[model samples]
Every structure is written in structure tokens, then in C-alpha cells.
Target: MQETIKKIFTENIQVQIAAGEVLPSALESAAFTIAQSLINGNKLLCCGTPSCHMLAQHMAGLLINFYETERPCLPAVALAQEQVNLGAIANNDEHETFARQIRAFAQQGDLLLAIAVNGNEKQIISAVEAALTRDMKVIVLVGDDGGELVGLLGPNDVEIRVPSKRPSRIVESHLVNLHCLSELIDLTLFPQEEN
Candidate 1:
């Protein structure tokens, strides 16, 4: 048992470091793009699964709290349907509701950050296409297998690909990488002020 526990911890740390190596560049690019978009006067809309949406929400919180950017806080507008509780109305919407909210939230200089694990969902792809057509800047953070999502992105879009093959560690690694990104964005966005 002692040996097993020691091996587990060792393996876990190694896996995290390896995953980090694959993630930092993408995360940096995504965070920089987001910070730039907000600095240039763009509201942001993030959409993804419940777990990934939680990540997006946390990212938004970090942006507001640490970056001090005057950006709008709009989260997974499309996934906000099916609310058993009125309090959950804010983040639970169906497809049409998401579309409607997205259309209203997006503008010429605004941005849409789409988060996906598989990147092959029809609804998500469609939403991404719609956002792109409207000329909003797009930033996609998807797992490496999310090739389908990549096809929809244009030159202005930034893509962050995280290698999440291990189901057991994907969520944990993703959260760590994302939190690092949030911290970096905070540092990068506020360097001048900090100086």
C-alpha cells in the first residue's frame, strides 16, 4: 500500500508536468487574445459543457477580479435552457435561446470563446460558425481531438488544444492549466499598471 501510494503520487506529478508542457503555449495564446480583445473594447461570450462552462466562468471571474478589464460577463448562453429552478436561468438555455442571446450579445468588436472537449458537436459548431459570420473575434479552447472545431476557425481565431486522453486526469489537468492561464492573463494584462 505504501509503495502503491508513492508510485501514484509520482506518476500524477509526472503526468501533470507533461500535460503542462503541451498546454502552456496554447493557453498563453488564448489568454493573450482574450486580454487583447477586452482591451480593445469587446464583450466576451463563452459556451461549452457544464464542466467546461464552469471553467469558462472561472476564467471570466479571474479576468474581472485580477485583470480589471471592463468586460461583459456572459457565459454559456446556449446551454442555459432546461432550468428546474428560476435561479439557474442565467446559465441554462436551449439552442434557440443560446442563439438569440448570442446574437444580442455579439457586436462588431466583441468576442466569443468556445470551449469543447470533443469539438465535434453540431450545435457547438453551428454556434461557432454563426459567431464568426457576425465578425466577432473567436478563441477556441478544445481538446486535441477537436479537429472539427478547428475547421470552423478563421485567421483571427486562436485555438488552444489540450491533450486530455486520460479521462481520470483530463478535468484536473485542464483546471490547473486553465487556472495558470488565468493567472498569466492577469499578469500580462496588468503589467503596465503593476509597474
Candidate 2:
């Protein structure tokens, strides 16, 4: 049992290290894009499904609250956080829950961070389309060759693909990526702070 646990941790760490090597440039670009959007008074809209949904909310909370720092709150919203709205949209439109939220809240110059381990979920694709229609820049955190979501990204958009097919490792890598991104945004926005 101890060996199994250690192996799991080792594999996760290995995947995360590989992801760090491959995804830093994309992550840096995403951080810069998010920082510029915030500096311009634009908000960040994040969305995902299941495990990714938790990550989306975590990222939003980190941005809107703080990430290892004492700074003013930044503007960010997790599209999946509103259960009532999501349930209503799911009941009514079935496939347009995230799309509806993106259409309603996202604006030009805003940023959309979409996290998907499989990267082919219908609602996330719909949200991507809606964000594009609103002229929002998109940063996708995906795994497993980026799946179909990679095809949806434009030249100006960014995709951070974790180089692993295992969903658990991919999700773990996503969490690390999210933390790195949040820290990058914090440092970029609040450079003078000692924290």
C-alpha cells in the first residue's frame, strides 16, 4: 500500500515536471494575457466540468480574493459556480449552460480560461464558441493531445496541453498549472509587494 501511494505520487510529480517544461511558454502567455486584461479593467471568466469545475472555481477565487498575497481583489468569475443558474440553463437549454453564462457575462477584451482533462466536452466547446463571439481571448488548459478543443482556438489564443493521457495525472497537472498561473498573475500585478 505504501509502495502504491509512493508510486502514485512519483507518477504525478513526473507528469507535472514534464508539463512544466512543455507548458511554461504557454502558461507565461496566458498569465500575460490575463494580467493585461485585468489591467484594462476586464474580467476573467472560467469554466469547466466535474474536477475541472472545481479548478475553475479555485482559480476564480484565487484571482478575486488573493493567492499568497495581500492585494486588492481582482475581477474574476467562475461560470460553473452558480448552481441555480447552471441548473436552470441545463434544464432549459441542455447544452448551453456555460454558453449562456459566457454570452451574458463575457465582453470584448475579457479573458476566458477553460480547463478540460478530456477537452471534448460539449458545454465547454459551446462556451468557447460563445467567448469567441464576444471577442474574448481564450486560454485553454487541456490534456491528451488537447482533443477537439485545440481545433477551436484561434491564432491569438493559447493552449496549455499537459503531456499525459491519464486523467488523474492530467487533473493533478492542471492544479499545478493553475497555481503557477495564479502566482504569475500575482507577481505581475503586484510586483512591489514583499509577499
Candidate 3:
């Protein structure tokens, strides 16, 4: 049992380190891109698979409320829960649920931040496709070779593929990635004014 726990911890750290080596520049680009979109008065739309959806909501909350410290709320919305709560998801096609919301809410220059813990997140890919048609920039955090989602991204989009095959490690790394992105966005948007 102890060995299993230690393996998990070690694997998580190793994945993060591998990600840290390759992802910094991509992270910076993504953060700056997100910040620029917000600066242009465009909102952020987030969605993910069921488990990853919670991370999407967390990112939206951090942006729309506060990340680490108090700051003016930023504009963001997590798409799936509202549909589920309103009972729309059941009525609408499950695959198009997020894509439908994106068409309804997104505008040109808006951003979509999507997290997919594995390569099999079909709905997330659908949402990415929808967002693209509306001219929204996209950032996807995916793992396990990025699946079909990788094939879909255009030159303008960003895909932060986690450096891990384990779903747990992928999800954990994604959380850390979200926090880093949120902090970077805050820093970019609200640099402390010199007294």
C-alpha cells in the first residue's frame, strides 16, 4: 500500500517535471492570448468531459471571482453544468451540448479553455470545432496523445498536452496547469501599479 502511494506521488511529480520542461513557452503564449482576449472585452467559455468539467468550472470561477487575491471579476462561463441544471443536456444531443452553448454564447475574439483528461473526449472536441467557426481562440489541455483533438487544432489554437499516460496524473497535472494559467492571466491583466 505504501509503495503504491509512493509510486503515485513520484509519477505525479515526474509528469509535472516533464510538462514543466516543454510547456512553459506554450503556457506563456496561452496565458497572453487569454489575457488579450479578455482585454478586448471578450469572455472566456470553458467546457470539458464530466470529471474534467469540474476543472473547467474551477478555472471559470478563478477568473470570474478571484484566483489568489482580490481583484475585479473577469468574464467567464462554464458551459455544461448550466445545460445539465436547466435539463437541456438531456433534451439536446449529448455530443452537441457544449457546441450548442458555444454557438449561443461565444463571439469573435472570445476564448475557450477546454480540459480533456484523456484522448477520448468527443464532446470537448466538438465544442472546440464549434468555437473555431465563430472565430474564438481555443486552448485545450489534453493527455494521452491529444486524440483526434490534436488533428483539429489550427495554427492559431493552443493545445497543452500533459506529459503522462495515466489518467490520474493527467488530471492532476491539468489542475496545476489551470492554476498557472490563471495566475499568469492575472499578472498580465493587473500588474501592480507603482506607488
lDDT of each: 0.65, 0.88, 0.88
Query: Which pairs clash inside model 3?
Result: none
Deviation of model 3 at 30, angstroms: 0.6
**lDDT by residue for model 3 (1-195), tens:** 999999989999999999999899889999999999899999999988887889999999999899997899999999974456446454666778898888888889999998897756778888989999998889999998889888888888998999888988999999999999999998899886767
The sequence of per-residue lDDT tens digits that candidate 2 reaches over residues 26-71 is: 9999999999999999999999867789999999999989999779
Q: TM-score for model 3?
A: 0.93
Clashing pairs in 1: 79-93, 80-91, 80-92, 80-93, 81-92, 81-93, 81-94
Ten residues in sequence with the least summed lDDT for candidate 3: 81-90
lDDT of 3: 0.88
What global local distance difference test value does model 2 have?
0.88
Instruction: Flag regions of model 2 displaced more than 4 Å.
Output: 81-83, 86-89, 193-195
Worst 10 residues of 1 by lDDT: 74-83
Backbone collisions counted per model: 7, 0, 0
